[model samples]
Target chain A: MNRVRRNKTAIILFIIPTLILFCTIIIVPIFMDVYYSFFKWNGMTAPEFIGADNYIELFSSKAMGFPRTIKNAFILAGLSVFIQLPISLFMAIVLARGVKWEKFFVALFFTPVLISTVVIGQLWLKMYNPQYGIINSFLRLVGLDNLCRTWLGDGRTALPAVFVPILWQYIGYHMLLLYAGVKSIPEELNEAAKIDGANSWQIARLITIPNLKPTLQVCTIFAITGSLKAFDLIYVLTGGGPAHASEVPSTLMVDMIFGRSRYGIGSTIAVFIIFLCFFFAVLIKKVFKTEVD
Target chain B: MHGKIGKGIGNKVIFVFLCIWALVQIFPIYWMFTFSLKDNSEIFGKNMIGLPHVWRWSNYIDALKVGNIGRYFLNSVFVTVATIMITTICALLATYALTRMEWKGQKLANSLIMLGLTVPIHAAILPVFIVLKKFHMTNSYWALIIPYAAFALAMAILICESFIEGVPRELEEAACIDGCGVYGIFVRIIIPMMRPCLSTVAIFTFLQAWNELMFAVTFISDSKFRTLPVGIQTLCGSYTTDWGPIGAALVIATFPTLLIYCFMSEKIQESMAAGAVKG
Candidate 1:
């Protein structure tokens, strides 16, 4: 009994500090996101309870353009899962087969993930500059002048242009996840396939890929959810720019919250993002679970 | 016999693929470096791929002259280091108890901490902002430090708990046999055994806090308190027309992170992979 009491006290002491911090910083704010979404409040005034008016305005009112932001975010998520994941998986399979300069390639690939996203935004902003930027200059060099556009400054090109840096920045991250998974597969499985006259692609398809399914699911979930919450790079690149061509949910929320002081609407946007993240996360798991069978 | 030639062709194809991908990954950073040293005319007029004509170092000097890159660098160093230290200590204690100690509510505590790993920063930024405002702590170092440490605690504890669980119970038992108390066993056994995991958590926490922009941008508006990401964003905003200085400021802001990644990439990748899998 004495020992139990002592252990209980010790555990509480060990856990309470982090518990308070997590609750105050993470958990409480989620609840508060819901609480504030019902009110029509700016940061300054006492919040007036509007009770779903914010949500109504958020969806029905076209002025906020929240629907457009949601579409943009989903587009990013789609590209990440389809275009980005396949490329990363291909690299990981090849790299896991053991290549020369693997360490050097891995380091180079992962370097961008280490740098601040804001810095990456600035890097691409320079590249996309209409006048002397590389994209336009290179286009002119190759006699593709007709194809060149103000990559980030034109609404026509800005959305896709914003994706380039974001794509570069995180490719290594997803690649690394799949690479670790590939490396964990037993070599004998591949060697066994090879002895049976299976080619490299055949070996990868029959032996390696089936084993990588769980990791594939995890990487997919991460990529999709991460895309849903994407902000910093977009914020720094264009602030959803060229007339909000590249606006995403997080950027739109930041604008509503901070720029216009529409706390209620801002909170509504926040709640929307939270729901999307949770919804996609759960849905991805369900989809993956079905795939396993 | 045919397999050997086929394998040879396969290797060649993969090598070509890798070289193109590597170029795409690396060319932007090289391009940034080249432009950082160019004058405006050289930048606008010269070949887009060429090195700076004069190797002008003045861009760096002008970048510094115009803004608080130096101050922002120091603030980032302070906030990141402070956050990492506090987070590691808190995570270690909590993980030690959660993994090693016998107690009630262990399951609840563990589940609660795991849930924090998914709480997006945007979802919580408003409440944290309002809470800090109420405390009159916005734009203060504490404002950034508290939230950074709190959010990071989940991942830190996650990584540390897994590592601590692997540490053989025999060591702790042996230490206890030597009359070492709970604290001594932790200090002598758990801490030492968990060094690699600690550094993994340390590097992760450092990078997260260092590159973080949302909290820094929103919670702390004063230039005096601004960290590198926010400071550099504003710096770019002011110098939009002048690519050279903005490029220079970017290179300076990014160099340390690049350097660390260059040196410690394996640990960085391992920690990231672990985080993704465990979650």
Candidate 2:
């Protein structure tokens, strides 16, 4: 009894500082986000309780076009899972099979993942620079000068322009994750398939892809959640754009709090984002849940 | 015979394809570097793609001296170091208590942390901003450091949990028999064993708080307290046409992270992979 009590006191001593910080910063804010979502205050005055009106406004406000932003996030998630993951998967498969200088290419690809996103934003911003940027310069170099308008300034192209760097930067992260998974797969499986005359494509499709589904699910969750949280790059690149063309929930949340001082609406957006993130996370897990067929 | 030839061709194709992708990955950074070394003439002139004719070493000086990047760099370094030390120690303690010691509320604490891993900081920062504003912590170092440490706790604790669980409890028994208490065992036994996970956790936390933007951009309205991301954002904004110094500022911001990653890529990569699998 004395020993257990002593250990209990020790545990409390060990846990309190972290417990206070984490709970205050992470847990309390979540509840507070929900609490503040009901108010209509400017974040300075005492919050006037408005009773879900902010949520109503969030859903109905055409100007916010929050659903559009949510749609955009989902679109990004789709592209990430379908386009980005496949590219990374292909690279992982190739690297796993056999390639000289494999480690060099892996490090090269993953370097961008380690890079600070703000710097990446700056790099891409310069790439999308109107006058002397590479994309425009390349267009001119290829005699497609007529196609070059301001990539970021033009709303039609801004989202895709922002998406491209995001796609490039994170491919290696997913590639690494999938590569780790690929590396762990039994080599005998591959050798047996090869002995049975499976081509590289067939071996990958038949053996590797099936085994990689769980890792793919992890990459999916990361890609989706990451897309939902996409702010810094877009914030630096377009600041949601010349006209809110690339606005995501994160940027829009910043806009609400700091830009418009609509703290209530911002909290409302925050609450919705939390819900969407949870929804997608749970949904993805369920989709990837192993079924005993 | 034909199959061997076909396989050889396929290898050649995969090699070329990978080279193109690697070039795509590497070129932007190299291009950024070259422009960082060019003057306005060379950057805005027809030499956009080529190497800088005259290396403008002054771009670094200009960016640091004029662009507020130096001050922001200091701020980032301060916040990053503070966040790392606080989070690492706190997470180590909490994870130790949870995993290695007998404790009530362990399951609850673990679940709360799991919940935290899912709670996006950006999504919840609105209220946190309000809370900080109420306390006048805005624009203060505490605002960034405290939150950075707190936000990092979830992942750091989670990673440490997996590692500490793998640590054999037999050592703790031996220490206990030698008159060591829980704290003594944790400090002397578990801490030494946790070196690998601790480094990974430190690197992860460092990268996170260093590169963080949303909170920095929002919380620190004062330029003096601004970190590298916010400072670079504004600097790049103010100097849109001056690609040289702006790229230099970016290169400054990107340098330390790229250096560390290049040196310790495998350890970092495996840790991140471990994190994903554990999740």
Candidate 3:
């Protein structure tokens, strides 16, 4: 058995294919992204190396709006953590306490996540349609006609408007994670708290929330990192316009590469986005760590 | 008794809230179905929320015929199927080697593969385009499949690794002692035991490749090789005056996923929860 398990030929044969593919397609491209960021190439000519210029321009060039996109992403992340997670946590706790149609609600809530982001974007597009959308129609019927404007067309509203559906789509996802965490807490722990004259709020705050620390940490990381990389819905809904108001790093990267042929700048944005994700991921883990210790 | 009454009221409030949230979650899909069957006037006019007056089912036909969504659908299916097969097979075999086999750099290799999870798809776009262009693989199905499979591989391997770890070594040892070789033990013993894990990987891969918009849009410009999400976006662009056809295209694109979820929501949820730990 030991001899068979240590067969070098079998091991090499089994792992080599994936290792090569993963390297070429995933790992190699990441390094290439970092490498390409230092060069000024238009995708047609020989690349000219301009070390750190792209990065410098990406931050200092006001026209690039890179900082604004990052700010927009932070706002989205803020809303996701503060608003979306609480709603999900509320739903998870209620359902975990045993409710009618518990399984049904879970399945239903997760349906949006199953559907493509493009489809969700389109649905919300119609829902936000100024002339005949349900939102405008309701606003008109209720005599708040002033609120009826092109939600995706106005620069002031485009960012938040795009965020509504993006946030809406993921509620069930966070809820499911927290739901699993809530369910995994032993029933006896809750029973003991109850027997000690702890009310439901006390039990939830002390027992459930602390017990859910790991899951909450994971959820926070996902929400923050996901916000940093948010692209599809914003692309579909606004394309980072009315005037680049809704641009996130991912969309800005796409615009740089395809829209303007600024491949080097695009790679710079890509690298920045990657850095932000790793930075936030580590920061979030630290924050969650201190709370537990 | 008063406390019991208060508890009843609380449950009632919670139920109502849950129902409302569920409705908010599902209303859009239901609305999509209804609006897909409505013409311009009904969709924009009084019949927005209620049932369509005419139920113009020809909108689906129009989407297939005029919008050319069928070609894109087939393209998406082909790409998604290839991605699933490549990702699952590679992930399973590599996981077997990583977990069961003794090797010098096994831990290092496992960590490297796991690191693939942190590398977002956006980070690879520009460089991959350059790589694909060098090979002249752009505008081909392989362009989409190779990258999609690569991106999905890490998560699939993670899922497979956890499942394979649970299987006792006794089975493999017994098989080996009974004259089975490494290949024989892997195929005859391990592969059969990995059905659930494989399915989870397949489903997760399907979700990734099927709805992928970024790479599909970036790499493949040829209409002949375009996938559903891209096609649907184009359909939306072209049919700006009339949205019923766009809704129909969305439904057509969404149907397979919804159908899969209907049967395997539990599996999908479990897989997503596990795969999501990468973030």
Q: Which candidate number would show the highest DockQ if scored against the true structure?
A: 3
* Candidate with maximal TM-score: 3
Tens digit of per-residue lDDT, candidate 3, span B1-279: 339889899889989988988899999999999999898888887688888888787999999999999999999999999999999889989999999999899999999998777678887888889888999988999999988999999999988988997888999989888999999998898999998788889888998899899999888888999999999888898789888888899999999999989988888888887766544
Evaluate every candidate with DockQ and list the scores: 0.66, 0.68, 0.74
TM-score of chain B of 3: 0.97
Put down candidate 1 lDDT per residue, B1-279, tens digits, no spaces.
456788788788899889999999889889889988988888886656788778888888888878668889899999999999999989988998888887778898899988777678898888888988888999889899989999899999999988887899888887877777777877898889999898889888988999999999988889999999989988988777787888888899988887877677788889888877877
i-RMS, each model, one decimal: 2.0, 1.9, 1.4
Candidate 2, which CAPRI tier?
Answer: medium
Lowest summed lDDT window (length 10), candidate 2 chain B: B96-105
True contacts kept of 1: 0.68
What tens-digit string does per-residue lDDT give for candidate 2 at A1-293?
23832476788888999999988888888788888888898866787989979989888999988888898888898899899999999999999777988988988998888788999988888888888888888898899999998999998999999999998999999999999999999999999998998877788888998998889888999999989988888888888876788998889989988999998889888888888888889988888885412
Docking class of 3: medium
**Residue pairs that clash (backbone atoms under 3 angstroms), model 3:** none
Per residue, candidate 1 scores C-alpha lDDT tens digits across A40-142 of 9988978999998999998898877889999999899899988888999999998889888987887788777888888888888888878788788888888
| Clash totals in order | 0, 0, 0
